[model samples]
Target: MMKINQHILDFAKVFIAINLCLVIYSFAFESMHWLLNTQVAFFSSLFITIASFLSYKRNIQSRISNLDMSKTSKTEDRDKIDEIDDPYDLYTEYEEIPEEELTPEKIKEIINDEKSKVRKDSFKNTLFSAGGFLSIYRVLGYGSLLFGFFALNNNGIFLPIAFMIGLGVVPLGVLASKLLFKKL
Candidate 1:
């Protein structure tokens, strides 16, 4: 059997639990419209969150695999827990160049190269990368949210409060999941 991802299982549990509560509320209130509106928003947000999560996970995996083995080995002696929690070190040491090599032209060239790299990395992270904000899945996700909201509202089936609650489900679920999964 193929192994299922634990994060996805957590999300599924969240989805089911929220909807089950809503179902009970719907039954008591006898308001199917509220249930429908909430479901649409909840499902759309959950879909988007899952897609972005998968994209981010893929990006991180690739980054890890592409890291220089020598650098990884140097950090291997540190606490294993810290490495697992944060693989990327936020502070990197800078190498110093001798004053003799710091000519105006050389300085200009170095600055330009750094600028270009920054621009390239920023552009890639903002749009071209799988986990970027403008990536296909993200775009689709927002589009679905907007269209779903308008569709339900236009049909006179929307409950603003219920829809808002539904939209909040993912963040709440994520928080709850983290708490549930936190290390002792």
Candidate 2:
């Protein structure tokens, strides 16, 4: 899909840009240790962020699909209205459930139903689900980042400032990609 391709392109751009800088630094300053330190930190963080993004994207897509499947006659009416004033449906749609029919018990029932759904979708329950926050890949990503950081520090190869900079590469890459690829 286009989304997957875009992610790959962004990743490639970021990876190349950061490593290119490191390559030049290694040649000019002749400090391979700095390059190694930065690389480990950058890579581990990249793993974590990318895994998190994929999980989140999958979660959103599933929710959208569920919504699409549950469309009803009421929603169909709204679709006709949306074609008039708000052609794109850019504004939030209000429910047709009238205020007069909203009795105390009805409100309570609605609230309870929503609460139950929230409980079902809670982070703890979804931790290892397909689109979960703590899915296996994400857990591994976090583990790699944590262990990599500790290993670097324990071995006394920790260049504190450089390591921090390396950790920032992904975010910087995201920004750069957005700027460079923005549609006019």
Candidate 3:
């Protein structure tokens, strides 16, 4: 469950990155005459970078708080349901001792049982998501690349420059996200 939420969060990160690129592209090239300079472009890029970083940080903190809450509740429930008092209640009441006393064979069996216990929290996340989010960036990049070629063919100036901005803006956005959120 934790891993699934993380992947969903990653998708959100990529989604924000792609949108930031689009915003920067439009602001630098498709804006008014006063905003036609590269200064406005860089400013917009910086604004988008900081904004996305704040949002991603907020999201990660929220998820971690929720996970902590769930963890505490589970431990509380386990303690309340255990119908044991003191002394012999050393282990949980759910455990079944195999032998009468703690003989060498019994100790071995206990160790083996512990080793084979099913720990849901110990599972590892796979090195993939439901779908790769990079494909969206690729499509965005290719579309801008094509537009760039067309803009170069015509007497256009902003479109070609905007295409270059769009090409590299996703990486910049991603780097900002990582730097601020401290995650990939």
Query: What TM-score, over all chains together, does every model reach?
Result: 0.68, 0.68, 0.28
Residue 50, model 1, lDDT = 69
Instruction: List the lowest-lDDT window of 10 residues for candidate 1.
Output: 126-135
lDDT tens digits, residue span 148-176, model 3? 45544464445446445544455665666
Error of 3 at 26 (Å): 6.2
lDDT of 3: 0.49
Each prediction's RMSD over C-alphas, in Å, is: 5.0, 4.9, 12.5
- Candidate 3 ranges beyond 4 A from true positions: 1-144, 151-159
Local distance difference test, candidate 1: 0.78
lDDT of 2 by residue, 1-184 (tens): 3455765776677677876887688668857777777788788888888788788878777765755433323456566666566654557566678899999999999999999889876954465355657667799998998898899889888887778777887788777777877732
Q: Tell me which of candidates 2 and 3 scores higher on lDDT.
A: 2
By lDDT, the best candidate is: 1
**Local distance difference test, per candidate?**
0.78, 0.75, 0.49
Clashes of each: 0, 0, 0
Query: Least lDDT summed over 10 consecutive residues: which range in candidate 3?
Result: 124-133
RMSD of 1: 5.0
